[model samples]
Target: MNRHRLRLVTFDAFGTLFRMREHPALTYQRIAQAHGLKVVSEPDRLKASFQDAYRKQGASNPVFGRLSQGSRPWWKSVVRNTLIGSGCPKADVDGALDPVFAELFDLYAQAAPYEVYPEVVPVLETLRTTVCEDKVPNGMGKGTKFWMGVVSNSDDRTEAILQSLGLAKYFDFVLTAYHFGSEKPGRGIFDEARLLARNCKAEECLHLGDDLERDYNGPKLIGWNSVLIRRNNDHPVPAGVATASSLKAAFADD
Candidate 1:
């Protein structure tokens, strides 16, 4: 097993950092009822969809796969993907989705509708303060050179969402699926983020995320240290990699 001491810490956005719009399930339930779509009606089903929605978006965007993430607007891609995934016709997907997309926008008016995890704020506060107090490789002085960034499987809009919620300025840079033009599990997004973060050695940084494959294996393959934030489930720890029960635990060793 490789033991790593990190100088910078990057993150996987969406499930790993931001609060998911937990109400999406409820919103979808309403959509199903009004549209008579044979879609999920159960609470768990709706909750599941919130995550699934992004997966669908991540998988479908051609730009994301091309590694030009954050350069394009993912919201439009999202609307298109949502409609297609919902089984709407290609052309109708655009029209019928306008209002629904608007509803999501309304919900996500400023920052995403989902609340940041209880652990997130404190963890970020710690990182901010630590950067102010500690030294690391790369002349990273306490609070100044510690480059904090996010490699998200989301659109460029996510930056605005984070900024709206007061989390963006803390990030030196953010690379999303939109930025890379594809989502993770493919490594394209990760590579692009690393480039934006300046290709610091994998060991010099720790990546925190919620997924096993995308956030773990992808970066791990390239030598970056990984910390999986297991959410909504009890997962056996991965061999050679660390797991954080909460964001705070991730900073314990730091």
Candidate 2:
């Protein structure tokens, strides 16, 4: 596929652009301990509990409670459940959930626990500023402008996180599932992104993300071009999927 023809290139935020600096369970454990709560679960158990809590929250309150409770309450529930599931006594968890959640919420909003991938900045710069000859099949034309944006299944913290990492300037917009009222693996979110591109069509857009279904199949199902970003080396690229190891590699042909 000739990427030069694409007008908008959107990315999935969390696993695509940046990720946590350390295991989230460890951070949670430390925070709980610091807040004078006794967490007796092992790290692995805590991690599992956190995952369970997150999934449960998402299932019960879709899109981070955009329709009902709201993002703050939804996240507070996740944190509270995580603490309870991780073997912290319910009484202690209840006492500290609010302050612990507040600190975690603020911590994630900054760059404290996250790290942007190495190749992200250079690749974004090349896409945003590099001009190419119109006659070249794979080159982006000087007159053809491409917009960059982020589509994340997260709360309001996404944009702040990007800003803290100095990545916000590269994108035209950031759409969070909570704010947008739709999440990935559903066409509404991807369609919202296309609409945000301003007069751009589905065929003129492309999305890159770490998840196979949400990032790859979801966009493709909506008539937009998509690439599955497989940053991990443990798994082989799925058959016939447009897979890339990194953002730079995704546009290597261009």
lDDT, each prediction: 0.64, 0.85
Q: What C-alpha root-mean-square deviation, in Å, does candidate 1 show against the real structure?
A: 5.0
lDDT of 1 by residue, 1-254 (tens): 11123455788777777765655556644553464334433566445545566666565645443453432345545544544555445565455555665565555547646677778887787675553344554454554645678887665567788878888877888877665556677766666665666565566666789888888887878777777887765767657766777777776764
lDDT at position 229, candidate 2: 87
Which pairs of residues clash in candidate 2, taking residues 3 or more apart in a chain or in different chains? none
Give stretches of model 2 more than 4 Å off.
131-142
User: What's the lDDT for candidate 2?
Assistant: 0.85
Best by lDDT: 2
How well does candidate 1 match the true structure in TM-score terms? Answer: 0.71
lDDT score of residue 84 within candidate 2: 94
